[model samples]
Target: MKKILNDPKRFVDEMLEGLYAAHPGMLGYTGGDLRCLVRADAPVQGKVALATGGGSGHLPVFLGYVGRGMLDGCAIGDVFQSPSADQMLAVTRQIHGGKGVLYIYGNYGGDIMNFDMATEMASMEDIEVRTVLVKDDVASAPAERAETRRGVAGMVFAFKTAGAKADQGGSLDEVEAVAQRTLANTRTMGVALGPCILPTVGKPGFTLGEDEMELGMGIHGEPGVRRGKLETADQIAEQILATITADMPLNSGDRVAVMVNGLGATPLEELYILYRRVHQLLADQGVSIHRPFIGEFATSMEMPGASITLFKLDDELIPLLDHPAHTPFFRV
Candidate 1:
C-alpha cells in the first residue's frame, strides 16, 4: 500500500505515538503502553469511568474520543483487530473510579470476546464492569434481529450519550442504561464508493469499480449487503433513510439527533450535500432535528463513503446529547 510510514510491523505503535504527541494534553499513555490511552487526568473519583476499545485505523474513534466528557480511557488494538483481553483490563484499571466502570464498544465478535474476558478479569479485582454493545446498522440484519447488526457510525452517538451521563456523576448501572438506550434508539446505514489500502497488507483489502457502490459496508472492509451502480447523493440518502425509518419508524412531532458521518475520504462538501437531503427528508416527515452532527464523527482509514445515523431522541436523551463535551476531535 502507498502510505507514509517506515515499518509495517510498527504501524500501530508509530501511529499511536503520533496521536499522543499531537494531543498530549488530552491523552495520556499508561505504563508506557501506547495502546492504553487514558484521559490525561483520569480516575475521577465517585463518577462512573467510561472506557471503550477495539480495532484501530478508525480515527476519532478508539482514540480520538478520549478526553473530557467523552471516554475516560480506551484500550487500543492494531488496525482492524481487537485489543487483547489483558489490554482491556489494564486500561480499565487506569480509569476505574470508586463508582465503577462501564465498558462500551461496537458489537463485533472479537470485541465481545475480549471485553467479556476483561470483565471476568476485572471482577476478580473488585472492579464493577458493565458492557454495552452498539449495533445500529439496520441494513446488516432484519429488524426482528437488530442485535445481529454491525455497529457503525452510530456507536459515536452512544459514546457521547453515555459519556455525558458519566460526566454528570451517574452510577455505573445508570451510565450503562443510558448507553443501551442510545443504541436502542440509534440506526445507521452506509454506502461505500471506493476501497482503502491497509498499511500492513500493502494492498487494498477490498475493491469496487469507479461506477459502483456497496451498501452497508462495515468499517473493516467487510462485504456489504449489496453492490450496485453508484447513484446520486440524493438517491443514496433516500435509500438509506427509508431503511432506517422503516426499522425505527419516526412519529410526527418526534425529535431526533442526526449524524452524517464520513467513512474517511469523503469531503465535507459532499457530506453536506448528503446532509441537505437528510434534513429535507426529515422535515418532510415532520421530525425535528436536534444536535445535527455533520462531519467525520466515525471513519474508516481513508475509505471513500458516508453513513447516516439517526438517534431517536427523548427527554432524557436530549439533555445528555446537549451536554458540553470536549474531545480532541469532538466539541460542543
Candidate 2:
C-alpha cells in the first residue's frame, strides 16, 4: 500500500498535471473542467476526429493513444471510473473537424452510457458522431455471443487502424468501418499474477497468493476464470494461446499481429520471457507474425500480469498497421 502523492483525492488531477508537464508538446487540458487531452494542434483541418475515453488506471489505454496517428483527443476519468457525459461532449466539441467524429472505446457499462449521452448531446450541435465498442476478451463470454465479451488490449489496434484511415482522408463512415473491422478480427485473454492498489484506497484491489495465478482476469481486478499453482512460462503461454487460437482459429499461412501486454508491474524482462514462448507457439501453428508489439501497451496500475491479443490481419489492415504512427507511448 505504498504510494507517492500529495492527496489521494487529487490524484487524478495531479497525475494529469505531471503528464502535461512532461509532454507539453503533445498534451494539454481543455476548458479546464473537462479533463480532455488533445493533440496540441488538433482538428487537423479536413480529417475526421477520432476520440476515445475511459477510466484512468489503465495507462496508454485512453490517454497514451492520443497522438498524431492515433486518437485526436481523449477524455480521461478517475481511476477505473467512466468520464461524465459533459466531459465527452467537451472533447467532441474541441476535436470536431469539418468531418464528423468517431467515439471508439471499450464496452463497459459506464462508458456505453456516458458515450451514448454524449452522442445525443453532439447531435444537438449538428456534429455527426459514430461509435464503436471493442469486445475482444473471449473469456468474458461464450463464443455463441462473443460480442458480449469485454474489451482488453486489442483496443490499441483499433485505435491505430481507425486513426490511420482517418489520417489518409477517409470519410467518417470509412474510418468507423476500419475500426469495427479491426475489433471483429481481434481477440484477447489475460492472466493475473497479483492485484493492483487503487491510488485512493492505498491497498490492493484484490488478493492472490504468492504461488497462485489467476487466468482470464480483467484489467480492473475483476475475478478471473481460474486460479491454480504457478507453472512454467511456456505452459502459461500455451494455456492463453490455446484459448485465443481456439476462439479465433488461425490456420496455416494466416498472417496476424501479436500483442503481449503487461498488466502493470510485470517488467520488460519477464514480458519478453513470456513472448519467447508465445513466439514459439505461434510458429508451431504455422501462423506468420505480421507486426509484433510487446510491452505495457495497457496496464492496471501496479498489477502484476500480462495479456495476449491477436489480430488476424488482412491485406488492407497490414498496410494501415504499418503506416507511420508517432505517439509519446507508441511509435512506428
Clashing pairs in 1: 1-202
lDDT of 2 by residue, 1-332 (tens): 57778888898888888898898888776778538878888767899999999999898888999988888999889999999999999888888988999999998999999999999999999999999999998878879988678888999999999999998999999999999999989999999999998888888877899899999999998788889998788888999999988888989889999999999889889889988998888888898899889999989988988999999999999989998888788987
lDDT of 1 by residue, 1-332 (tens): 66888898898998888888888788887877899889999887778999999888888887778878889999998888999898899999999988888888988999999999999999999999999888998878888887788888888888888999999988888899999999999999998998877788888877898899999888888788889999999999999999999999998899999999999999999999999999999999999898789888788888999999999999999999988889888897
Clashing pairs in 2: none
With candidate 1 superimposed using the best TM-score fit, by how many Å does residue 148's alpha carbon deviate from the native?
1.4
